[model samples]
Structures are given as C-alpha cells and as structure tokens.
Target chain A: AQSVTQLDSQVPVFEEAPVELRCNYSSSVSVYLFWYVQYPNQGLQLLLKYLSGSTLVKGINGFEAEFNKSQTSFHLRKPSVHISDTAEYFCAVTLKGGGNKLTFGTGTQLKVEL
Target chain B: GAGVSQSPSNKVTEKGKDVELRCDPISGHTALYWYRQSLGQGLEFLIYFQGNSAPDKSGLPSDRFSAERTGGSVSTLTIQRTQQEDSAVYLCASSHNSYGVEQYFGPGTRLTVT
Candidate 1:
C-alpha cells in the first residue's frame, strides 16, 4: 500500500516571503512523486513531479521540490510567493509498476497574504 | 488547446437520489481518472481508466460509487443513493499516458447532497 502525508494543514506566509510545504510518503516499492496546486473553485494543477530524474524538480509558477529518498519526503518550496499564490497544495505518490493510481495526501492550504 | 471539461459544474440532489457526473478528456489522451475532494477528505482517487484495460476501482469508497468510460474519451461517474457524505467536488483528469505523466484536470463538478 502507498500513502502520503502532508505535514502542514495550513501555512500562512506574507507576500515575497519564502514558503515550504512539507510532504512525506510511505511506500513499499519505488514511487513517483508529485505536487499539485488548487485555487479556489478550481481543479488541481500539476506543480512539479519527480519521476526518475534528479532529486530537485522545478515546476510551474516558479515552484520547486526536492525528493529526499532517505527521508521519504518531497517538500515543495518557493523562494518568494505572491498574493496570487494562495491555494491548496497536495502531495501525491504513485508506485512503480502499479499503474497510474495516485495516492494523495490530506493537503496543505497555503495562504499568501499581502 | 482546450483542457479537460466536466459537465454540470454544480449538482444539488436529494439524499436518496442518483447523480451522474460527466468528464471529457483531451482529444489524444489515453488515460482518464476520477477523484473526489471535500473539506473533510482533501482529495481521494475514485477510479481510473487506461485504454481498454480493466478500470481500477481500488480507491472507490464503496459499491454505491461506480464509473464508466466510453470510447476512451468521455467518462461518467454514477453515484447511487447518494448520502450527505457523498457531497464533494468530483474532479476528472486526463493524461497522454499513465506512465508518470502530468495529468490535466477539469474544473470539477460540485455535488451537494441534501
């Protein structure tokens, strides 16, 4: 079984400040990790993904995440956020050879304030 | 290019009634997925379809929830005897292939069971 855990339920940060949303996963086999963002009244959008490449993955909207295999973590980070960056972020994982079924975390609400 | 689209953006139904949510994937996408999002449950995988392979129903909560994809392009998720717990945003996503590719999402159908 595969599971994902998002450490922060809510993260409040001011505009132009750095932000990091923590995520951790538990899987018996190798897995692919992803971060998605969802704005109010909208569906989720892919932020970044770590398939079989470098540990650090950059995504849309100037967001990036580093895959830490030993720590079983893939945390999303942004050097500086904007007011429009306020949204809910989710960490998800899919196991290798397990098809495309994604196990998502509870989610972290990123509230970027001015 | 137009992204994934879901019909009946908002659906309000009685507790015992049935509701059908629809999803139209991108033209060349070969994989489609269904997910549910709610305040209590952040995001959950409901089901997935890939080409002509058997649909993965592992993530579906119960037998009351069922989905089908026709012509490998459009999908319909049917909820029988809906309950208050079934109230959530039903999201649909599509990808060119299921091999760790980025899935594009639709706006989602907000189902409110009263």
Candidate 2:
C-alpha cells in the first residue's frame, strides 16, 4: 500500500515571505506526486504535479515542487506567498499503473498573515 | 469549461438515516472518484469509476457505503444508516483518463449526521 506523510500540520508565514510544505511518501513502485490546495469553503485546486521527466515541476500561482526520488519526497515551495495563498495544502501519491485512486496526506494548513 | 460539481453542498441528516451525495464530473471525463474528508481520517479515497471498468470499492470503509456512476458521468455515494463517524465532506473528482493525469475536484458535499 502507498501512503503520504506531511510532517507539518500547520505553517504560519507573513505575506511576501517564502514558504515550503514538506511531503514524503512510502511506495515500493514508481508513483505520481501532486500538490493540491483547498481554500476556505472551496473545493481543492491543483497546485502542481510531478509525473515524469524533470524533477522540478512548476504549478499555478507561482508554486513549485521538486520530486526527489532518492529521498522519496515531493516538497511544495513558493518564493513568496500572498494573503490569498492561505489554505490547506495536501500532498498526494498514486502508483504509476495503480489506477487513479489517490492516497492523500494529512493536509498542512498554510496561514498567511499580514 | 465548467469543472466538477457536487449537489447539496451541505447535508444534515439524523443518525441511522440514509443520505445520498451526488457528483457530476466534467463532461467527457473517463474517470471519476469519491473521497471522504474528516477530522479523524483526513482525506481518504472511497471509490472510483473508470469508463466501463469495474468500480473500485476496495477503499470503502464498510458495507454501508456504496457508490455508482451512471452513464459514466454522474456518480452518487450512498451512505446507509449513517453514523456520526460518517459526518464529513464527501469530495468527487474526475480525470480525462485513469492514467497519470490531473484529476479535477468538486466543491464537495458536507454531510453532518446528528
């Protein structure tokens, strides 16, 4: 079975500050990684994904992530965040050929303050 | 184009009652999935439907939980004899295919069992 682990339950940062949300996964086979953000009273929106090729994958809203095969991690990072970036972020994983069912992590709440 | 949509954004039902949550995936999407988000479980995949393939019920918690996708577009997650434990947000997502692709999410249906 595959699983995702998000070490940080909550991360507080000031506006325009950099932010990083750490994510680790346990999977025996190759897997696809993804980052999703869920704002207050809204559905989850895709932030970025790492499928193949480049280890550095960029996503919408100026967010990006690096897929480290050796470390089994896909950490989300943003050079600078805005107040609107405050949301709960989730890291997910799915086996390469194991269908599209996603194994999600316990989300990390990113609280951006002014 | 419109994204995935779920009905009855909020549902309040009494314990022991039954509830049905609906999900309308993006048109032409070949894969649909159901997930539950709760304080205890976080986010967990409950079921998945891909075209005419057999639906994946392996993630379902118990027999009381069931889901079906009709015409490969709309899906319904039925929870029979709901319990407080079932009080959570039921989210639906859809993807173009069952492979390594982005899955769009719906706003989710918040079910509260009193």
Tens digits of per-residue lDDT for model 2, B1-114: 999999999999999999999999999999999999999999999999999999999999999999999888899999999999999999999998857799999999999999
Candidate 1 lDDT by residue in tens digits, B50-104? 9998999988999999999998889999999999999999999999775788899
- How does candidate 1 score on lDDT? 0.93
The global C-alpha lDDT for each of the candidates, from Candidate 1 onward, is: 0.93, 0.94
Calculate the i-RMS of every candidate, to one decimal place. 0.8, 0.6
Candidate 1 iRMSD, 1 decimal: 0.8
* Runs in model 2 lying further than 4 Å from the true structure: none
Candidate number of the best lDDT? 2
Kindly report which residue stretches of model 1 are placed more than 4 angstroms away from their true locations once superposed: none
For every model in order, the TM-score on chain A comes to: 0.98, 0.98
Model 2 TM-score on a 0 to 1 scale: 0.98
Per-model DockQ against the true two-chain complex: 0.85, 0.88
